[model samples]
Target: MSKKKKAKDIMPLLKDEPITEKHIGILEENLQKVPGAGKKGIEKALETLRKLKGAKKDETVNWQTYRNEELKFEFKYPKELDKQFISVVSESWPSWPPKMTIGIDATETDFMCEENPNYKDESGYGERERVKINNAIYCVTSTSGAAAGTKYVNYTYLTIKNSKFITLTFVLSYPNCSNFGEDNKLKKCEAEQKAFDPNKLADQILSTFKFISQ
Candidate 1:
């Protein structure tokens, strides 16, 4: 809406013709009406404008940190996520609910084959691959199941930090709301589920996890 404000102290200036958020929308809508070179410059300016406003679409800058002092690890999460939605368990075989949870498991077990790392319910089922997060290599697993018109998606990230195994898991249960045999309620629930992506949010949260020195 105005010139970008600097983090440092500076003098403010008045504008002869101020641009508003509505003007941005109008420009975006009519971008195709402009010629090729003109359109490119306008697009670049819009990108800079968005950066100056310190805003990104569908992204949150304010995040809360979760630290485990004894385990020597920490991660961040968006403040909009209720703390009640997260849990941590430190056990040999940690069980996960159909929700968000992070775990540090340092179990002494030989059941898992070193080559595959498949361990009963703890390991991911379908798509398994290696991914690098925060400069650390992690194995990712994707598992899915469905029951009674509801679908469950489980994404698990596993890695070893400081000789201890760590897991960052996100489970999404779609259309969890009970429709009670009503068409309108079912439609509303399905619409909500289709509008949001669980995996993208999982990636954002999982990337914040980092191991600290003991």
Candidate 2:
């Protein structure tokens, strides 16, 4: 007997398919119906779609490449990190992007990274002073041309260890989940999982990270 097909199974068949600008317009219209999905939120979704469309071939990899429960996925990184940090992320949520991506960027002297002290807590959660590291995290998701609408939950974190700047950003995202009314709650659920905390989202950010980059 054959096994039943799952959404995951269908994803790959459609992965390479591109989304059109007209499709993105549909997303913008649907997003307006959801509460709090203002101009900025709609723009965010559109931007994510653009990024996904702009993704090049070499920068792409599969979940199986980095396979592990916490580290069961492959991705493109624009920076180099200590072996330990890389391992931590790989083992923490390797397949986080699932069929999508978790964009990461690391550089030195980014205006944002330099202000660690301001974002840090009294207990020094973010950065003690200035470890001199910068990083960004993002994801791309779309349902359909070159640019499909998308939703991503991202974070920027900085950690300086062993005389090296270690900045790590990981994401859990859903692409092409923007058509709230057209599609089911898949996108909303994905967004909630990444953006909302178990209790209250505001509480989570304040309690855990102390700052919300998004």
Worst lDDT 10-window in candidate 2: 137-146
TM-score of each: 0.44, 0.22
Cα error of candidate 2 at position 25, Å: 54
Tens digits of per-residue lDDT for model 1 on 5-90?
22011112112324457646755665666656456555755665555445433353467677777756677666443322222222
Model 2 agreement with the true structure over 1-214: per-residue lDDT tens digits: 1111221232343356675677577656756664552445455656666677676443222212322244233233323222211111233335232222222443433323234333432222322232221232211111111124533333333432222233334433334444555554765545554563311211112122211122
Estimate the lDDT of model 2: 0.35
Scored by TM-score, the top model is 1
| Residue clash pairs of candidate 1 | none
Q: Residue 32 in candidate 1 has what lDDT? A: 62
